[model samples]
Target: MNAARTQTDRTTARSPRPRAVLAALAAAQFTVMLATSIVNVALPQIRDGVGLSDGATTWVVNAYGLAFGALLLAGGRVGDLLGRRRVLVAGLALFALASLAAGAATSPAALIAARALQGLGAAAIAPAALALVMESFPAGPARGRALGVWGAVSGAGGAGGVLLGGALTEAWGWPWIFHSVALATAGVLVAVVVCVPRPPGGRDEGPAGRFDLLGTTTVTLALTGLVWGLTTARGAGWTDPRVLGALGASVLLLLAFVVIERRRPDALIPPRLFRTGRVAAGNVLMALLGSVWIALFFFLPLYQQQVLGSGPLATGAGQLPFAAANMLGSSLAPLVARRIGARATVTGALLTEAAGLLWLSRMSADGSYLVDVLGPSVLVGLGLSVAFVQLTAFAVDGVPGKDTGLAGGLVNTTRQVGGAIGLAALTTLAGSVTAASAHEPLREALTAGYRSAFSASAAVLAAAALLALFLTRAGAPPAVPPAAPAPRPLTPEPSRAP
Candidate 1:
């Protein structure tokens, strides 16, 4: 009896603290997301430093996203098989080395190669880190709080990238931007190793599933082609031969991938995942949210620079309001969800986002940033942050620990793919509008194009709102410690009040 009591007490004492683990995981997430946008502001300096041709300059940015999006599923499967912590640490090491290489690159090709490597490392880090969060926090308020921090970091990371990159490039140099990332990554790695605990099972122990080579190759290549084609189409026309060819290849390859996965005993991403209504719906909503978020960032900058005549510094500063609001929303998401339920929260958020986009669509060439842009920016920021927090939590809820990494990968892939495709479509539409209005003054023409794009984005958000009403209704009973009640079903019966 004494020995049993002592053992129980020791086990209780050894239980991990949630705060340290959440901080480390949030930091890891922030580091990888920061990589995505940090290069944008430094592109000109990078081009000049490396003597990159006009066309080659784009590759420096595109290479990372291509590799990240293509290999995310495979990375997640590796984590599920090998171990999440092991994969995360390995990814951080690889990311650090790649960042160092990128910082030291003397040529465009070298920089692009390093960036791609960084993407591959990020693919590993992102899913594993998310899985760690899922495993560490139980399915209740603790988990909700952790996810809110993660979502806040994700939103702020993107916004901060522009600010950090510009400051680094202007003050120190272009290479320092990468070097700074390398140092931050190194610090996060140390923190993760020290602070984040192993999953409920011991570290480095997971089902040693057989690797699926054919499935991996087909899906990775298919996604690569899709993202590349969409990204290129934004610059080159959709009718461009390369764009059309890549899209064609993506479709055929995706079909082949589906066939391979159906037959394979160990698929990279099991088709069964999509069969779950909650998982499927969460992914769909995330994709829509991602599309609108990316489009907002892409076009708002153009509006600031072209229509408002803001300098780069001022334009970057103009984004601060959105970032601040997003962080506030992330913090508030869990509290609001607990009060109202996830279904209502998501529906309300989508509607709010649609309203914001509609307001933004009313911008004119003569509009002032403070007077016209601030309100909509804050609304959209809050909406995006709240939606991200709820969707991310819901997507992985009730997923077995073994497949947590896979769930993470699927949500991320959907977001990336959706953003790429939606941005391409919206950009094309905006370009056409601009060309048609060429007879108008330049500022007016540009404003006209931006307005049309924002209007389309609003429609997309509204459509997503309708889908959310149906799809996000499923709810798991909250695990202990007194959090929210079971979320209302997305498609509740008429008798049950949503």
Candidate 2:
């Protein structure tokens, strides 16, 4: 499938250009998501470096999710309006510059702003990369394989991000995490401009459709307000007037955005897309799966730190199985999907994820990685492999070429938004329960928070299972036509009639 896309992506990509293009595009996805996970393993250092509280520090993470989530559809649309290759190049340059700025930053506010800009760049790059793959490959054996690689990079990027961050932060400090990424960004930016081929259409020279300004503003504010309220409400009470106002305003803003979308001719997301049962199911599942992933990474690291009493390096060690397992699963997904179909692969995946959640929930104070984490890690890895590929295929399935960007953005948007919502809700749940407990202040409270996040993650994965069941059609392979009946050997009567 990837080969087919490679063949179609451009005249330039027909031979050696394919390998270069794939590597650069994959590298682009890997690097951007790396920023999400890389800084995560260094949160303690980041907090101290910026002179911020743990609660304030969480915003550094959420800002990326919020901006990336809200602007994703628009970004995808922009790529379609302009060109995927062009937007990708521009985004890469912007991203590299942002990474340099982030690394040089000395204050929390500066880091937060830098991360937001990074998210904006990522928003442009992600959908463009995926759409380019989709536009290149036809739906069949080849597309599935390409999607498998695409899924793996996304799923494994999180694990690799944290691992890379841990190594860099320990050796070079938190700022170097951003610095290391900057170096890659600079290299990849050059590669993209040089190696990545332009789409068949040259560039979108169609009429400039009106940008959905009102929809953009409302959606961004709605998501940002909601994430802020939920993140902060943990430290301040939910009823704290500021938190309440923010949460309330966010809800109102979202409602307004929905109303605007329904009325707009050039809606970022058309109303009918939601009505497509498959697209709707796939979008919902992506969001839930995203929530599971982001929340797990957030709390699991805490488990090693506060619960298991590990430092950053030790936390990185603890993630070894998860990182390795995800990598292994990702590596094998394309081959497996080709042998067995994407439908069966994804169905099995969601179920396995639910089981992994149940196993992970068994974590205890005395738990070891072998007993408490390894099996679940492998299962979650497998699930990620299946879900990521299937969901990407699911979103763009049967969408018109003109709406390809919208299709890609819809799935990616679900993921980022789900993560934001998941983080807010999961974090709030943990904080609220911990605060109400009669235990000594911090550690026990945080433990309760971790459990809250885990349990919520499990629930979201469970919901994902249900959504996948409904969203996917039963037959992944189309039915073959019956063979024509064999002719009688040299029938003289039939020959005469003919």
Predicted model with the maximum TM-score: 1
Task: State the lDDT of candidate 2 residue by residue for 1-498, as single tens digits.
Answer: 999656545543243344455677878888877888888878889899888787678777877776787778888888766777778888888888889888898888998899989999988888887766665554555555566677777766787777788888888899998888889999988887766554334443323576777887788788778767766765676789999999899999989998999899988677656443356666777788887778778777777777777777777766777766666666666556556655565667777777777677767766666676678877777777677767666677656555666678778888877776777677778777777864765666666666666776777777777766666655333111012233222110100100
Name the TM-score of candidate 1. Answer: 0.91
Report the lDDT tens digits of candidate 1 across residue range 238-346: 8999999999999999999888888998888776665543777888899988887777777887798789987556766777888898899999888888888788888
Q: Mark the 10 consecutive residues where model 2 has the least summed lDDT.
A: 489-498
List pairs with backbone clashes in candidate 2: 1-142
* Poorest 10 consecutive residues by lDDT, candidate 1: 489-498
Candidate 1 residues lying further than 4 Å off, grouped into runs, are 1-16, 199-203, 271-277, 474-498
Stretches of candidate 2 exceeding 4 Å from the true structure = 1-16, 199-208, 272-277, 331-343, 436-448, 474-498
How does residue 53 of candidate 2 score in lDDT?
Answer: 80
Estimate TM-scores for all models: 0.91, 0.86
How far out, in Å, is residue 381 in model 2? 1.5
Error of 2 at 294 (Å): 0.4
Residue 132's C-alpha lDDT in candidate 1?
80
